[model samples]
Target: MKNPNGFGSVYKLSGNRKKKWVARKTISWENGKQNRKIVGYFETKNEALKALANFEYIENSKITFKQVYDLWSKKHFENIGHNRATNIKSRYKVHLSVIDNVSICDLKIKDLQKLYDNLNLSSGTANQIKSILKMIFDFAIRNEYIDKNPIDYLEVKKHKSVLERKIFTSEEIAFLWNNINLKLVDTVLIMIYTGLRIEEFLNLKIENINLEERYCIAGSKTEAGINRLVPFNHKIIPLITKRFKEKNTYFITCNNRKISYSTYRRAFIKLMEDLNLKHTIHDCRHTFATLMSNAEANPASIAKIIGHKDYKITEKIYTHKDKNELIKAVDMIN
Candidate 1:
């Protein structure tokens, strides 16, 4: 009755001290003085003890967003390569990293939604951020930091005018072909016909291509972007043959290692300036799908060639407006 532990003392202080149990724990010493905190009040001793145990565990083991993210970043990006890890970290530093000190249990959907709203990222990037956030929260939940993930039911949505994948019109494709010089013409044609993303095309090593098979393995990022086979057009054959003649590590070699995306991007910018054309390199892939669809290529074949897991996507997002066909249909409607 004289000596007591800070966990809580339930002694008769008044007419046989009421059976009031106060759950308490010492977080730390402040200014060389032991500082105590009251966790909660319970009706029974066992309840108070149980509460104290939970409070101790949570207080001692609470994971911050930084810790969870660090753990997740290592596992998710494991063996993914340095470039990808750097890219992932860049994205994280902008949003997720800001809340590094915030406990995962304290992470709210609204907190995340605010970050998303302010990011001004494209639909794809915003979705990616959301995915990573949800994943981190899921990890937190598994570790018992929180019972449920706040992001699991979060209602964050992409803006209506979010930047979408830019597709090149048929005429634009024709113009690019006409103006593409010999230096990078093969690069352009390979991209246009194979539906390879710029990164995929630029990063292509000899192992990723098969001259005899007339197909190139290209992809990155998603499931559709890994080890996907892109069949060549009749036109890309000659170009591939020529490139094969030159011994190089990457398909897009600039005298040595595969030309960096930045260096080549600047060159592409200069070419676009000279041609007075405005389009991202990704437009080439979109142009490929559009051209394939216009040529009445089977949807399944197009999806496979483009490495799309969902074939319907080719019909939905890849198809572009045909004014002539629209006019014909409208005339029938009238």
Candidate 2:
């Protein structure tokens, strides 16, 4: 029968499992063409009535995608992280004009997939878009804006892994230590010695350093960003001392501001070219792990130093045993 609101009709279907309720709405275009659509199925008759009410409201109000996204953003800003929210808002702006006039309920998976695939974005980036859509739909479903998640079955194509752990040779490490510009020499040395992520290094403060203890406190990027004390060797001590003499600030910087990752990466690329080495800034951390493993540093000790949440993750990524050492251990059993 016709809904009192005049937006749609509701019907019940018999099934072995349970009774299913369905709502249908019709839309007329400027060309005098009409299209009928089934909004959703509900498990309970009461839920179906609620769905019919919502459908009537949506159809009557002619709500837009932008309007719903804005409403969703307001309700769930805290659910998203700071870094992620920034990117999501930026991407939404780019796609807003094309989809803004479209109804929220009419947002099909194909439309989203087409938008996702047409962009010349990395797989990681595509996944982020997918995640934002998922969050939006999840909020809608939770609030009963929609009965089911339309984009739930959308598959994000996986990109081939390009990042490999490159173990820097001793010569390459020595070359980098000796050849990088003197301005960033101390900062690079600190990374080599401490294996701190770029963000952690940039955020380092003078108060975190304990000169007497020959260590510094820093946080990691991962959820394991708990404060950890990293010990410094003799080589790093001189570098830190020299920096302490030159700058009042805790970190090495150009023009009194913290160095950006892009700046460091460009400089590192030049350094790599000069040394004829092919390695990423990440190689410094891998080199640290390699050297530590070669020195027979205990996995537990290394994990604690690296602020890894568990030794198993450390073992999975960083524990590469030497062939000769393995042979020696095997011989001992014989």
TM-score against truth, every candidate? 0.50, 0.53
**Winning model by TM-score:** 2
- Model 2 over residues 47-165: C-alpha lDDT tens digits? 77776666533552366767678767975777877656666777777654478888777888888777766756667766777777787778667645667787787867765555677
The true-versus-predicted C-alpha distance at residue 129 of model 2, in Å, is 3.9
Estimate the lDDT of model 2.
Answer: 0.66
Window of ten residues with lowest summed lDDT in model 1: 325-334
- TM-score for candidate 1, please give it: 0.50
- Please identify model 1 stretches exceeding 4 Å from their true place: 1-81, 85-116, 127-158, 182-185, 219-226, 313-334
